[model samples]
Target chain A: MKSANIQLETLVCPSCTQKIDGALKSLDGIKEDTLKISFATSKVRFDFDEEAVRIEDIEKAINKVGFEVIKSRVK
Target chain B: MQRFIFRNKNKIALINGILIALAFIIRWTAGYMEIFTGLLVAASILGLIPIALQAYQALRVKVVSIDVLVTMAVGGAFAIRNFEESAIVTFLFLFGAYLEQRTLNKTRSAIKALTEMAPETAWKLMDDGEFEEIDIDDVDEGDTLLVKTGAKVPVDGRVLSGEGSINEASITGESIPVAKEAGSGVFAGTLLDNGTLQIVADRVGEDTTFGKIIELVEEAQESKSEAERFIDRFSKYYTPAILLVAILVFLFTRNVELAVTILVLGCPGALVIGVPVSNVAGIGNGASHGVLLKGSEVIRDFSRLDTMIFDKTGTLTQGKPSVAEVQSYGDGIDEARVFLASIERESDHPLALAVLDEIGETDYLEVTDTHVVKGGGITASVGGCRVIVGNQALMTEEGVPLSEQVREDMRRLERSGHSLVLTAVDGELKLLMGIRDPIRPGVADDLESLKKLGVKNLVMLSGDNQGTVDAISSELGLTRAYGHMLPEDKSAYVKDLIGQGEIVAFVGDGVNDSPSLALAHIGIAMGSGTEVAIETSDVVLMNSDFSRLPHALGLVKATSRNMIQNIVIAVGVVLALLASLIFGEWMNMSIGMLVHEGSILVVILNGMRLLRYKLRPSYRLGSRE
Candidate 1:
């Protein structure tokens, strides 16, 4: 298992976090329970299986939900 | 076109506003209903693009957001042929969102400001023994770096060789320049004021102290409190509930305009944003001022603290013992000090260092037969004369007889809480040195400020003897004092106080105090304390400064109060808008959107007040001396 933190541009509204969370949860490799998205800081943190998914795929999923991903780091 | 609409949202809002004004002008001046209606339709369509796109994205995720409510309201107004209301409402919604976005970014500026201060490059030593500039990320532990005057220290390291003053305002929020020399530590992001330093990096990248501070503060601002969590849950069910109420109103009264107006007023935007803004601004204010309130929950708990427990040695006193009083018993006092310094120079005890420090510039005499006592002082023969340097029991064991005046002096020093060091030369009392740890300067005034901030009980707990504890406690006017307290005893006492319905905050700067720090209602650590204590603490006073304590308390109290005030403003405005829509005649779709957005701005402006919070000057009343 690997963890990643994705920074996004400033989120204007609180409910936008739900939209981002739903997009990330639908991916196969993500551990749904470990997902935390903070609207105040506009940061997304989650743990996923490396064998099942790559970080670029997670970024793509967020972009597909209409929010741009500024950067992503895998830890 | 979709990309253009997303990229130029502010532009679209501005153009939509122009169209609305032009339409009204045509209706009032020219009385051309056809051209005015055409302009209104154009404005509504232009303003609806971004709002409709956001609503569609939310719906794709199966969520009904405030954007969806406003979009549906605009569509319903168009269906009823209310072109003016539709155009005005969409323009107001778009303009309101633009303003909200701008002000919300200002609340997170603290994190942005800290990231800007992060050092980006270093001058590292190359293989040829010369220095080369490199990115900070490329620097690693054990890499030697050179720092010039007016340059930032690129990593946390020790000064291999240098003498200068460094401004550590970024690390400790104290802007005073500190003198640095060989073997002294320097943190990343601190500026060198005047000299050059060659330092070897002990920690690099994210492991540096500045890096940890930024990461901790970012996490602190992001973490939610109880009020925020409650609002998150409230808004989840609230937006959909408002939709249901709008549908019910439409079905009962067959009033489409009234139903759409209700949807516009019940967006819950301000209520969703109120608490988090207060938390973010409060945490941000604390970071820039050198106090680290770990999270929103810490802010809440710290504000309600009633009893504050202090560890005596490091928290209240300077933690370094020094010679406070001295007396000469007989002749050869200067010779006795030379013997004392000679014996103490061979020992590395803390008290020994204190005695040696006091007897500066003394001559070292050649001697032999140095014997160590288990719990007493050392006995050594110096310059053909036997010198007994220890406590009273050690003197007695060495067959040194004490005179009547010497006994009286011992009693007097002990009563005053001094750790007595007696030196006897050839069985005659020669010197008496009373050593004690002095209280930190301005601590009394800080404690008084804490009292004014409404801490009901100020207590001290220590491992020292009762007489010493009593003397220090009486001097500071503490409410209670406990002596000879082990770490577990301190934790147990804190637990007992909490059990009796007292909110406890423990302040300490030692490894042994970690347990008590963790068990208290609020754990405040000194910045210079051990990692264990800092890790277990909920609040950190950078630089171990006692003065920031009162400022921290005042800030938290003001922050929590600010949170409550924001919540009231948000909820009260929503209720007032809904109440007016139901019974009053002045309510409309355009007015509802305007007031809804205005309330969000008000709450944000209120939360921003924390950024300028300072402890009132009256709190420093006792600092004059």
Candidate 2:
């Protein structure tokens, strides 16, 4: 399993995190328990199975939800 | 084009606002109803694009956001042909979002400023022995980097050669330049004020101390507190509940305007944003001031601290022992000190180092017939004279007679918490020196400030002997003091205090203090302390400064209070808007959205006040020596 931290542009409202959270949860290979999207820091953290999905796919999912990804790190 | 509209939503908001004003003016002055209606329709459609787009995105994810409520209210008003109401509501929503984004960015500026200060480039030493500039990410551990005057130290490393004074404000929040020479350690992001240095990197990138500080602070600000979790849960059901209420009202009364107004007023914009702004601002302030509050939970616990326990060595007193007093018995005192320095040079005891340090400069002498007395002292012949350096027990063994005056001096030194080191030359008592770890300067004033901040009890626990503990405890005006406590004993005592209904915060440094640091209600570790202590503790005072203690307590108190104030402001504004709508005739969709956005700005400005927080001068610990 690989963990990733994704930074987003500033989130204006707390409810907006729900949109990104729903987007990431719907993707394949992402761990449900490790998905944490913080509206305060405009960052998302989650663990995913590397064999099933790549980080770029996860960023695409977030982008499709109308939020821009500033940067991401996977370890 | 969609992306451009999203990026320039504020510009569109300005155009919509002008259209609304022009329509209002035309309707009142020229009575041109067709042009007024045309302008109103254009303005409403222009403002609705961004909000409806956001609402569509939210709905695609199965989420009910504030944008959804605004979109529904504006669409309902348009369906009912309330052109004035529709135009004003959409304009208010867009303009409100613009103001909110601007002020919310200000609350987050503390972390933004820190990220901007991160060093980006480094001068790397090539294999050819020439220096070349490189990106910071490209530099690796064990690589040698050359740092010039006014350039940031690109990595955490030990100085291999050269010298300079570096400003370490980014790491420790102190702007004063600290001198560095060969073998001195430097951290990333510190600027070399003058001179040059060649350093071999020990830690690079995120492994550097500055990087860890940024990461820790970012995580801290993002972590939720108890109140925040409650608010999050509250809003989860709140928006949907407001929608249900709006639907029921329209079904029961057949009143479209009343239902739309309820939907607009029920947007919990202020309540959703209030607590987080305070949390982020508080943690940011702590990061900038060399104090790390770890998370909102730690801030809550620290502000309620009732008793603070301190380890004697390092936390309260200088850990290094030094000579405190020197008394000589007879003539040839200079010769006696020379013999003392010579004998101490050969011994590895801590007291021996203090003796040699106090003597400063001395001549070396050939020694003969050296004997190490078990737990007594060292006995040797120096420069053809018998020299005995040890405690009084060794004096008794050597039959060195002690006069009544000498005995009185010994008692006085012991009472003052000094360990005695008596030196005798040729069986005559020659010199008596007192050694102890001196209490850190200005600690008394810092303790006073802690008291002023409402810490009910101040206690100290130490492994040192009781006399020294008593002396220090009395001098600093601590309420209680304990001596000869092992690590387990200290943690057990902290447990006992917590069991008895007292909130405890333990301040300590060193490996032995790690257990207590973990067991206390709030563990505050000095930044320069061991890795285990820093990792186990909840709060860290960067630079190991004792003065930041009172400041840390004061800051948390102010932060938690600010959070409550924001919560009240948010909830109160929501209640006022609702009650005014039901009890009075003046409430409408535009007025509701305007007040909702105004309340958010108010809470954000309240949270931002923490960024300028400083311990007042009267409560600040006096200047250090």
Candidate 3:
């Protein structure tokens, strides 16, 4: 099972079409082994280990980066 | 949902819930009993179309929107033959969407508010030099425009003719009517107090000052609020997560009913809509009140701030000064007669004028070797006395004897909030004039208010000497102060604070303060500051009221709280609805829809309350000691 952390990739607000980068390189609880976040998804993608981190934690990490993690396809 | 959408976030949430209830009633009440009996259920399903469209958009963008979670919950109930539950789920989802949209619009209203500030038309100068009406945007650069009494200047430009007082309270936040003569600069949205003027337009359309303001606000609006950010990421994996859980439950228990119930309960419409809806409402509240918060991210960051810092000269003290006292003692002198004659005619400084105006502008011989120290005092030679005039440092550097009379007088002057200048004549003490920069009115009250409002630290930062900074800071009862900082140093200090995990905001109003302002968590630029400061700041305080700093923070904190509450409410409703489907079996489409819609209403209502935030409120007295 993948880490429960989800990531949504978006550009910085109105700066340009370029991808949003870091204001915070390390986010709270993002380092936990149960969660892994990547902002490669144009919208959002979540990979989760049911035991490691709750879905709420994943939402939190994405919010920290200034982008919303909306719905995603179930693979 | 229709009613909620029109009323804004809270209203939308309520309407969505109602529609969801109607859907559940139609789906379950029919129960294949009679086709005509399914009117409520049919309405609920029909209502889902709008939500589904948003969900589809979410998927196209590759992010699972909260709409999907809602849709799944309602659909699950439908599959389980719980028509009422299904309809309720969809209705609740719609309500959440409506609430979110409404709230978002409010938060993003900065541009909308600015656009409405300027009048729709300008007096265009036609070919024959006759004035004709034209759209404000159509007025071009270098075009001459006529402005009459009570008219907003169409563009940022210089007045070519006419003189009058202009009320610049809207754009630059200068409350006093600024006198505008030929060559006086004017901005796009200031009122002409009395006189008509011809202005040469420097910018037009999107390039105008007002246009730039609108663009800045719009740019800020596009950024997501903290609540929106969370829901955005949450919805991505949340939908699939719930679906997987339903699949897992079915596989483990071999009960399709339990699986469908889990799906119904787990749909996260309320959860998804809750946060963004609250953020939007908060944003709208800020805009309506002339506070422009860029986005939810700003709102979130503002709440965590630990230190509030300010630039002293303009941000805290009024940058105006006056001559306080004059003392003259020269042996070859009539005490006041000689020095007054020289200073009145020789110096061009405002301090000199104040002195000359104090006494008559007496005629005197031109002083030779006039020199000025930019941040310090001035000096000149006069009447063969070889006068050395400056602050105490300049007098002491010249080895002028400090007599007992002068010593007592200087010490007394020091105790008063005054700047002292010493004039030494031909190796003899001549004159001492004390001038002072006054503290702004109402500043002490604002600082006290900030302290009462739970600001952890209030610091005054300035490039002036420790004495000046300390004097003002101590008078204001501030705890932390940094004095004698160069422009770069100020910025570095603010940056260091931010790096140390202190969410710090720096307020300033000059080119000197620009770097530090940008480095702050929220750079609150004074409305009356130079243009450089206005461009660098994240938030512009339209008025130079020092109190607005605290108010802006209060607004931010309130907005952040509302957002968090909204998200929790949305999530809570989803969980409760899902549980109703599983263990209690209490959810039908109608009841589920009602609960969902009600939850949205609760969150939206919470967010809307931010509009009621006030600068001051009556307080109940504290316990007697």
Estimate the TM-score of every prediction. 0.92, 0.94, 0.72
Candidate 3 per-residue C-alpha lDDT over B52-136 given as tens digits, one digit per residue, 9 for 90 to 100: 5444544544544445555665566566666655555555555554554455345444434656786678897899979998977
Q: Rank the candidates by lDDT, best first.
A: 2, 1, 3
Residues B103-216, model 1: lDDT tens digits? 888888877887779998999999999999998878989999999999999999999997989999887656889999999999999999989999999988767888887778
- What DockQ class does candidate 2 belong to? medium
User: Considering only the true interface residues, what is the Cα RMSD of candidate 1 after superposition?
Assistant: 1.4
In Å, residue B551's CA in model 1 sits off its true spot by 1.0
With a 3 Å backbone cut-off (N, CA, C), the pairs that clash in candidate 1 are: none
Q: How high a TM-score does candidate 1 get? A: 0.92
Return the TM-score for candidate 2, rounded to 2 decimals: 0.94
The candidate that wins on DockQ is 2
Best by TM-score: 2
